[model samples]
Target: MIKSMTGYGVANVENDRYIISAEIKTLNSKFLDFNLRSPRQFSDREIEIRGLVSGVLERGKVNLNIEFTAKSSTNLPVSINQELFETYFDTYKSMASRVGVNDSSDLFRLAIQAPNVVTTVSDKSDDQDEWEAVKKVVMEATQKCDEFRKDEGDTLYHKFKENLDVISKGLDEIQKEEPKRKERIKNRITNNFKDWMEENSFDENRFEQELIYYFEKLDITEEIVRLSTHLKYFDKTMSSSQSQGKKLGFISQEIGREINTIGSKANDAAIQRHVIIMKDELEKIKEQALNII
Candidate 1:
């Protein structure tokens, strides 16, 4: 079955030390484009998270957000660099004195806001436990996202089937009109030739040869057959277990070629109408195929 590239899933998992929430949203894309937003403490695990995402989702524009909240202050992930803070405080105070500004109350605040004054602390055992919890939530969220894709895929499958049936019915109508269309073409050509022959002398043998070639050129049998085959192939590919979006896109192009050929060759208005309907359905199929995976 096919899967849609667009979906959303969120999972929250909590433990004694921390509460982790993972949200994943995906949109259609030619390749995997991953963006991550998470606490700085999890920076080390970005690559691993990306691998997990690629393994599960395969292809899409992916946005993943991980919210990590410590349950208690003791489980905090950051620490103050006291030495750096003191250095910045002294620098700010000295600069203030040089500028004849004796207000030192805000110097502590400014020092704390200085770069590198706050940093993430990596505790091996606690980090391992927290990472494990984060992984659990992320995996659960990914599973939910896959399930969402499956549901969307199911909807697309029915829509595709509906359009395919319409196109198929249109093809049948065209086929039914084929004989009458040919008869009309033959009569019209013969009548035109008669009118021309009365006006001027013409070579009979060359005229017959040209008429045969003209009829052959107007024959739409090969195009109709190829179109039918492509439709069936599309159905088969859509029913397969793996992702076939690109393959289906290629098949749609072939179908379009056949439809256009039929439209150009079909001289009858009735057949042309059917061809137009088929073209419309084909455009719908192509548009929806972009969202498939």
Candidate 2:
């Protein structure tokens, strides 16, 4: 079914030992994009998350953030790398001998600056558990995100349906006055011939040809039919099970084409005014399509 690109959902997990949360927010976009804010240790999961989002959301400017909390600080002790320390200490002693600042305090300071010599007592197994928790919350958040998107989609569908109805009313007005417009053009041309044909013999064949050409040019029946078809297609796509943002966008483009043709072809002042109103309604529908998926 139609789903909006704009939505927000959050999911959380709580336990005696740990709590975790994940959130997803989306905005309109031509293609899928993501801005993920998460711990560095989980950076490797970026591709997986992207695939998951693409499968469900299809298209959007999506942003996600995940955070974890522990009820108490980890009690793991500090760790020191003895081999790394020895390498750093020897290198520092050599440098100190060269510079002639051979003091124990200076050696201690230099050794402290070495990378990986002292490190946190982080557990590899603990990391796996943390990832699992993150995955769980992310799944739950996606469920909520789907529900949120559907709720927004329902509202958008109503707005678009209203716009289509307004446009249909405008079309009806234009069609009702169609006969008057055609008659006005015919009368104008006949009056002009009466005034100008007195100068020379009237060219009946040329007048007939010109009348037919202008009549065809002003006829907006085909455009109106196409516009109606496009509107119907748009409504159908919104109810489809597949993600419909791209399809909806294409239908909107077709509708715009039809509207443009009608505007150019219908030279009547009243019809033009109504077309302007239709155009405004179409603009709003196009904006709504951007947020559909």
Candidate 3:
């Protein structure tokens, strides 16, 4: 199935002791680019979290943010920076004295509010239960992300089918014009040589051999056949239950090669117009395939 690399998913999980919120956002990338943000206490589990995300998301530029909040005061430990508080208090006291303020109560309040004056001490203890809870939240969020990718993939699938059909239709139009184009080429060549043959003696057998070789040089039959095969292969790959973004890209390149070959070799204005349309539709497919997985 086709899956888009760009998507967003979030999950919030809570219990009596903690509330955890996980948000994941992704964008198309050639390879996996994972970034994570979480509490300092969860630093030790970074590798595990990365592996979990990699397993689910596969390939993309992924940004994951985890917000962990303590629900119970007992679970959180608070600490006071006495030295920093003292420095702040003295500075505020000096400023107040210069302003002729007598109250020391305001100075204490200001000092307590200063940055790092009061902080929560991260619980570095290896708590298996908390890790399990966090893991659950992350997994749920990742699942939601995959679901989002699937939804986007469905939309892309329809879009790709539409463009492919248009290109196929254009190919059909070119096929319809092929007989007329060949007749025109033959007549034009015959007319141009009629005057020359009358003016100078030429070998009829040699002329026929050169004309056959020339026609072969201009033939696009092989290109058309190969392009049709590539199109079918692309459709089959899209239906497969695996990551095929890179494979789709490779197939598109092959399709382009055939399209270009036909455009250059066909040597007919009418067929060239159809080739242009097919090239345009193929470009659309290539652009969209970049975001597929």
* Candidate with best TM-score: 1
lDDT of each candidate versus the true structure: 0.91, 0.82, 0.91
Task: Select the stronger candidate by TM-score from 2 and 3.
Answer: 3
lDDT of 1 by residue, 41-105 (tens): 78878999999888999988999999998778754567898999999999999999999988888
Summing lDDT over every window of 10 consecutive residues in candidate 1, give the lowest-scoring window: 120-129
Which is superior by TM-score, 1 or 3?
A: 1
Q: Which pairs clash in the backbone of model 1?
A: none
Q: Which stretches of candidate 1 lie over 4 Å from their true place?
A: 75-126, 195-203
lDDT of 3 by residue, 170-282 (tens): 88888788889889999999999899999999999999999999999988888888998999999999989985999999999999999999999997899999999999999
lDDT tens string, model 2, 1-293? 67788888899999887788899998888888888887655777888877766677777898889876778865645688888888888888988899887687878777876888778764333477777788878878877887898899888888888998998898889888888889998899889878678878867999789889989988888888888888888888877777678888898899888888888877778888998999999999888887887
- Model 1 scores what on Cα lDDT? 0.91
Global fold similarity of model 3 (TM-score)? 0.85
TM for every model, in the order presented, reads 0.86, 0.83, 0.85
Q: Give the clash count for each candidate.
A: 0, 1, 0
